[model samples]
Target: MSSSNHGLARKLGGWQLWGIAVGLVISGEYFGWSYGWAQAGTLGFLLSSIFVAIMYTAFIFSFTELTTAIPHAGGPFAYARRAFGPVGGFIAGFATLCEFVFAPPAIALAIGAYLNVQFPELSAKWIACGAYIVFMALNIVGVSVAAAFELVVTLLAIFELLLFMGVVSPGFSWDNFTHHGWAGSDSFSLSAVGGMFAAIPFAIWFFLAIEGAAMAAEEAKDPSRTIPRAYVAGILTLVALAMGVMIMAGGAGDWSKLANINDPLPQAMKLIVGSNSGWLHMLVWLGLLGLIASFHGIIMGYSRQIFALARAGYLPPMLAVIHPRFKTPHRAIIVGGMIGIAAIFSDDLIQIAGQPLTANIVTLSVFGAIVMYIVSMLALFQLRRSEPALARPFSAPAYPLLPGLALACAVICLIAMIWYNQLLALIFAGSLAVAYAYYLLTHRQRAAAASDVLLEGNDAARLKPAVARSK
Candidate 1:
């Protein structure tokens, strides 16, 4: 498709891109990562988080180079396509879809869980599904309007985290953080080590999907300059928020109580202040902003990805049609929203060895993310060798070293997650196999159709030459 036909408007700037990057991931600070504490105690989870943080820092730095160089709505998919063939592109794109699509349901469920605190009469599932409808509409309206709203909500969410830290700082104690450190053992035992590995996915939740901001590359002005700034600033912001919330919540009280809960931050607020306190109520209400920011931001990410894939002929072409009026990927957004709502309602609560279904979904999302990271990193190396002359306004510092570290860490995380959650891993692998099979079956017909069109044009040209010669 031509650039004009792509239908995405370039209205986003550096700060807006930053807002998207942070907004896409800020929910991690609010919930989900606490599940790491459940698997590994405070210290064990902390260790896992530290490792994951390094991986993200390296990955973001290298990923920025690809985003600026390619600057496509498909993000990693575009990069992988350029480096490998159509099959590589499909793998990257499908993984990205998994990461962005699965994340929203988890965030939506959290939104419902947060709202459930105020209204016990309503079901969390219903609230979550309703949130999908509302946000998907906002996204379909326009990118600028949606991004501006994302920035405002993301800022508010950031402030709330700082507020939580200040409120609980007085009650913070080292003993609480150290209590049951290393998975409740006096020292790091084999089980503690196993728990640390199991905690990898939850630690990943702390920084997952931040890369989704790169999906906005096609919509950003001066992407070469803006993308790098947004990526670096966004990762730094998440690292700080992730560490702060974890420590503050853990130190506030018995950290174990906070684990595996949907509303860990608000629950921590209750521990620091009375449940009836106005502060607790305020936190609960304001905490919804965090969920809203991530939910809305990720919805934006997934729709653009779907739009890009469809435009590139990987999926159904209908999804590529942009709203002529709104100038948005309305079809893609609605389709993705339907999938998210279905996931929420499916309520697939198959527990694998004591892990909750929510955590399993989280593991699935991380599995997708890990796949993208590994493939994208390899694509980086491949592109450097094959497309050495390609314009790279932003280059990854330290070359092979940084990208290599990122790839290594991603592989480690992938292995750890598979070993820890074999059932979830199997499900994810099966889904990928199905997606690839469909792609292979359909892509051949598309190729044949294109060949037929080319042959028809050649025939027309030959007839024109013969008619002229006879005249």
Candidate 2:
């Protein structure tokens, strides 16, 4: 249980895992996804959200099979590695790292925006960087404390979203929601079609990192029983919240006004409640819980991913070191925090394809999530055929059907994201290329041995140094 042995302590149960699962994604309801309104208008974005919802529903259900079977902290990386070997592991691990590491900056910015309502003089970016410091420190303190905090904040966030919806219900108008719902025309014309396609990443924001719960598998009290329950409940909760929040917000006032901003709900609510209303101020404060939940949870996610990758020798071994007193991946947590802080500052320096910086960061993170999803589905298929004897406590109900559907949706979304955000896509691709080159030049042999150790259901970092001794 001590980091002296370099292993994670098991301290989570089904409800805590459920909290992490929902907490990781609840911020999508609070903000970020509203950019879809700018891209596709209300109706078009709703359609896009439906498409993305189907994908996540199928994906989380299907993804559970691999998670329970391997139960590794690496999550998709472990699933892909077991099914496709080192090369597969590299792709999934890197993509996952990108997804987790990049997602926090967007949430951090949302946190800053929420705080700005209460204190206008503060620089949002500095508040964002400050948030990264606070939460990363919390994550490094220990997994148990972090998960408990996630559960509490997640509950508060869910309650706040429901409160927003209730307070705005009397102002909801079907005509207001339907008013110019479709982008660019009376019907789904060429421009509307393009907008819907472009909206894919924003819609994806609704359920982006729910799979990150798997990163805590090493710390789950009973992953086999808990992961499935958590994932299933989590997806259902997010879907209902996403649909309800989006519908109510669009009808609350001019949907156009809420579009193109990081803080959507408060703006939408302000239209109904007035900017100076105590209800409006209450919302601004409570909404921060959603952003904080996601920001903090994703920090936990990225650190574990970095820890897992480093453990497998895919990165510097020092990055994998666990804290002896805290038994947390302190080094990995700090490294990911440093990267997120840099990204938060970079928001003011650049614009990609004329979209807002938040939009681009969201797409960049989605690209990584989609890529990881594709590799993971392929891994699931390969594992089914090749590892028939491997213990599977929970089988994906429809087998090829469910996974195939998830794969198809992921591929389509990735294609649309690339077409719409070519500049950011190129940036993401370039970063991956650079990292892969480092992997090839410095870590191949050690990573190969580490791969074997993982496949044997052992902690790879512990055995990684035994490579020479084994030979």
Candidate 3:
């Protein structure tokens, strides 16, 4: 295939897609962050993890259907436009942008926190800034670099998880399974459900870039065959990793010890490997490298989203521009990097995006992305019903049923997040509304101008005389 035949670049294959998914899955280290809720009590953590897993499962299927149908350069944005029109596309794309914009800093912040444990002398901000610079350079160079980076990072992540599980041979207290102690406090009951709800957004956030694999659909060697297969494999890989980490780490340590450490993986390692082993130090750094890879995945995902939006006329057209030499979404990559840099200065740096001021900001992004998923799923049902004859290379299993479950779970998760953080939900919804309003006004003005030209009759297609007008 000619290089020009594909938008941006046609460099990604099934392995690249798989590596991106695996890299993203292992990046956030849920067990590392969610250990707080576990320390609060086992049930709280278990319930929250299950809730997130279910929601995430649905999201994967939902993405699979849409990505399979319209494997375009823009991913969700293009699907929304084709299914719901330009305004719908704008909202979905913007929500995704909201998700992506928040993500880079969150990962950077987490990486900085981990660095603090190892290098207390250096500033977290400097380390984070440096990490962003490295990842940005990798992305601008091309997907090949991004894929290679993801491959190494993901492998390290796996090694770290396995090594930790191995070192903590006997595991921790079985009491952790039934212990009802709530994290942050000791109230465990229906009230803990509120705590679980409070935890939902970030729980969902852990899986933020899973859909990013879809962004590479246009570049995949065989999108129709590759997309669905990749989606299934990616989701399975994430679930296994998350569950394995939670179970293995949860089994090996005192829940409260996990609660104390800001970055859980290092703490877990300290417990399993102890301070004496030089080999343990190498393993710990492996986890850090995984964090770095996760950052790269987020950058790649959101940059493509920005590129998609620009291509669809939702943002400045420059955002959609591709680098002639690198064959990547160069403009969007730069823009996303700038957004990450600015996020470092925001006041709500630690505050989560949703309610009680405890809402996880990264989780808020996940909530918004779920909203996009719902939109895309609905689009799938509508497209199927309205255009039944349209050629579909690969339809999801059980047609409407599988997709329906995914949509239903998405709505439930959205409601859960809204209950936990009405303000964040309102912020997301309000921002999208403003964007949609702008789209409508611009579209209407353009239409009116076109109509005026039509009403001008022969003047619309007039042949000008050689003479000048009065002006």
Candidate 4:
């Protein structure tokens, strides 16, 4: 098939790119970050959050370099391939695939849990499955339409978070937030430091998947311009919102009560306004927009990844076939949805170390994400040395400093998560091993034979018009 026939349509502009970037992660604002409270009390998790925020700030700033220079849907996968060839591409691609594929089920379950707040009789698992089906359909219809929907829901999600902060201001109390804040102790001790590191996965949940926006680079109308604007703005917005919302929730009431549950905001609201308040009701309803936004956006991310990998013969080539009418990766979209739904069903079937199923899934996803981040930063350094003339519309500002900072933080998070969740880490490692073995046996030769043009991204000649316009 021709590239024209299979290529994703360029329909996303800067604002739309912002939507995907934020929408891909806005769910963290809603439910998952509270899990950090369980691992580290408010003070300890706060420390963890700050650490993660620093990592993300460095990662996104440096990552924008790869997105603009390559502008491929494969994202970190493409960058690694360009830097180190097929083997590196497969590792990054597999890690990214794990991150994107595993995330939505967790988000979908959150969506089901939110709706179950109003309708207590419904099964959250089935509802999660239904969500996977509905949003996957929406994603399959068209990227422009999906992106338009993403923008609206992401805006609403952002507004709802800000409103939560405003609504809780009356009851906010620093004394309440600070009391027993450091892992249930008034002051930090050596043991509390353990909690801080153990909380790294959930702290990461605060801004996870923001980099998924880079997967949409192929569809971005002007990647070199839109990606930097979208990414830089997205990171800053998420950091402010994450800290603000966490602080507001902690100060509202018994912070311990909000730690273990999935619906922290509504529970925090109830602590102040009682469960019957209209404000609480509004949050329950409007909060779905945040979960839905991330759920839907992640479906878009994983599908594009699957499409990219399959197109390169890393998976079945049929997944690369774009829908003629919709011009979307319809097959990839459906396949990923099936995987997510299956994961939702497996929640009851699998138990790891008595941990809640959602927490386990979150840890797994974070592991994949951290690995991909490490690989991507290394790719950035390698590309700098190898592809010296690659048209970089946005360079990593501090070169080795910023990218190295990102790499160090990612490695720390990976180590922390592995220490805290050894069983899950083993599972993730084993899966990666199995997948790589399969690739070597079945697809490595084809990947080796594929053209290096996409891998090298020596597209200076093609980027001439865009560069001229920029100049």
Candidate 5:
């Protein structure tokens, strides 16, 4: 099929990109909320909020340079393919798939937690299954459907947060904050930084997926301009929201109380707003809707990245195919949905097995992403020093220094993950090592094939403007 006829539509705008960022980050409950509160007390919350903000800034700056130059649909895979080669791109893309693959069950579990609050009798697995169905439907329809759904969910989440923030702020006790002060009885010293690093996965996970926002670069109008603005703005907004939520929630009650409560916001709301006003149902529904919207946003991103990887020859070609009628990557969408469904069931089995499900899975994702980020920042530096002539509308401030700090933090966080969650750390590194071995064996053939396609892509990209001008 001709490219245009394939229905691989590309039409998204700045606001929609913002929606993507909001949706991805706001889905904090799925991974961060539960894990973060448990792992880090007040200090962990503060350090993670700051660390993620800085790390995201670094990632955004590095990614903005690439998106401005390439402005393609494939996101990191495309960048890696162009900069490192087909094998590098494949690794980048596959790592992303792993993150998302693990994330679906994590989100399902989070949704299950929220649902359990309302309908105590319903199994969490069932709620996760229901959430998956709703998001899958949103994704299958089209990008526009996904975008619209995300915008609604993003707004509702923000509103729910606003309500929580408003309610908790007034009721916050300073004594609640400073009283016990810092978990495990540690004074302000170098030791505290160690705690921050250990808590980094759960804390930083909240801000991790802002990079997914760039997945919509091809769809965005004026990507070179829209991408950087949307990307930076999204990260900033998420950091602000996270800070507000953690501070308010922590202050409204003893930070220690959060460890006991499954749903901290509802409990904090109960403490501040009280239950008799009949607003409890609204809060519950609002929170539930936020989780659903967040899941919808996640599925959209994961599927798009899968489609991108397939298109770039990182996966089987069948996954790259667009629907002849719908112009959507229907195959990839279904695959992602299936993974999510499987996640729900697997989580249920874990409960039945009574095995200790270490929060290590969460740690694995954070470590893997940080490793990717480190590689990406290195790519950015290489590009700047090696390809100074490359057109860049946006550049990271302070040249090497600011981005240097960001890279340092990412590396430090990776080391901390190893220190705290060695098993997960080993698994993450080992998984990549396996992918590298596979690449080493088949890389030559893959490179030849990818090169031919990339050349065709370049020719097509050059011809596109002329073709439009002629018309």
Candidate 6:
């Protein structure tokens, strides 16, 4: 419990962690996944989604074992560090930072787009920047307060999705879904298969960053029990909601029409009820809740990841400081918020080769996610062999089989994205190279400082004693 003194209040339980998990991902249900439809059409995207869903289901089950056993704010970073040493840990932590940090600006832009539907005069960029300021302030106040707000917004967002399904269900048509089934191909061919491969990132959008719930382990009450339950409940809820929203939207009208748009759900709602109808209006207002839930939740996620890395000497120590009164990672949260806001304003629509900037950012984020997934799965197997007596409150069901499959699926997704987004892939690789080089130059000094702090009865004492007792 050295982390308790690190200043984060462990007020979250199963329900609150569930909210953070679902909230972190619910925006996917509202927007980004439709870009898959743009790539492969309805049938193509649906097939891609099925494979991604299988990957996520397997990964989540295995990931919970690490979460419960390690129960650190670093999440995958901690797992990799324990199993692979500093190098592997930095890779996992950096990838996680990329995944959580890059995601929010996209969601914030979507929020701006949603509001633009109502008030056409206000600029989306300004609106998004303003949102970051407001939510970041809310987050800096306290973990319990921020999580409670997340739960309320997450519930409202979930209700809005269900309400959307109900209204659009009656209008669903089989022909509309199949109209441009394989990106307008006459039938399934080699070209169609290639498109499906290209669509993997967007299909992943449906469940991307759901693992963020694990980042809250340090803030969760009885994380060994609460983390697994929240993860299980959260993924199930997302699977059901993702499938429902995709099917309803694709079947309601020409699926192609909604593809690649920033606000697919609202557009789909307009198909059933006219553009200016009350239903459409309701969706625009309530839909902001979905974007807010994710925008808020991911801010919480990235701050914790930054805090963990800083605390472990992988980043600037300043980021590790917790607020005295608020007891939150205020510095970490502000740093992440600043980065996201910068991304929002840099609205470079230029395509890297053929991929748009937004798609490129999303692709970069997925690249990070896939790397983390691969490393974490590898860490799980390594830990199993290396620490046979490790206290695991919850074991991954089916053991090697599930973790193995998760690894394979993640590897495939990473390959697909590289093939489709070569330039963005290179950019991501370059960023990692720079970060790793920096780590190599400074890690020894930081580690020495960290060791000194640990010996002085600080947060590291909490971790050292636990491991010693276990040995």
lDDT of 6 by residue, 1-471 (tens): 254436567799888999999999999999989888878888888899999999999999999999998888888998888887778889999999999999998888888999999999999989999999999999999999999999999999999999999999989998888886997764888878988999999989899999999889888999989898999999999999999999999998978889878899989978888897899999999999998999999999999999988887789878888998888999999999999888887776445766555676778789999999999999999989977888899999998999999999999999999988888899899999999898988755455434322112124565556444543
User: Which residue runs does candidate 1 get wrong by more than 4 Å?
Assistant: 3-5, 348-354, 444-471
lDDT of 4: 0.90
lDDT of 4 by residue, 338-396 (tens): 88888999987999989878888888899989999999999999999988987899999
Q: What is the TM-score of candidate 6?
A: 0.95
> What would the TM-scores of all predictions be?
0.94, 0.96, 0.86, 0.96, 0.88, 0.95
For 305-411, candidate 1 gives per-residue lDDT tens digits of: 99888876688878888898788999999999999888888775545667665787788899999999999999999989977887899999999999999999999
Off by over 4 Å in 2: 1-3, 444-453, 456-466, 469-471
- Could you tell me which 10 consecutive residues in candidate 6 have the lowest summed lDDT? 449-458
Report lDDT (Cα) of residue 236, candidate 4: 97
lDDT of 2: 0.89
Ordered by TM-score, highest first, the candidates read: 2, 4, 6, 1, 5, 3
lDDT per residue for candidate 5 within 395-431, as digits (tens), equals: 7777788778878878887777778776666667788
Ten residues in sequence with the least summed lDDT for candidate 5: 447-456
Candidate 5 whole-model C-alpha lDDT, 0 to 1: 0.68
Tens digit of lDDT per residue, candidate 3, span 287-334? Answer: 687787778887888888887666544666667667887888877888
Q: What is the alpha-carbon lDDT of model 6 when measured against the actual structure?
A: 0.88
After superposition, candidate 4 runs with Cα above 4 Å error? 1-4, 444-452, 457-471
Residue pair clashes in candidate 6: none
RMSD of each: 5.0, 2.3, 6.3, 4.7, 4.8, 3.6
Model 6, stretches more than 4 Å misplaced?
Answer: 1-5, 449-471
Query: By the TM-score metric, which is better: model 4 or model 5?
Result: 4
Candidate 5 has a TM-score of 0.88
Give residue 177's error in model 5 in angstroms: 2.2
Q: Estimate, for each residue in 1-471, the C-alpha lDDT of model 2 and write its tens digit.
A: 234646899899999999999999999999988899888988999999999999999999999998899888889998988788777889999999989998999999999999998999998999999999899889988899999999999999999999999999999998888788888455667788889999999999999999999999889988889999999999999999999999999999788999989899999999998989999999999999999999999999999999888877788878888998999999999999999889889876886778777888888899999999999999999988987887888899898899999999999999998888888889999999998898888664443433344443434556556665654
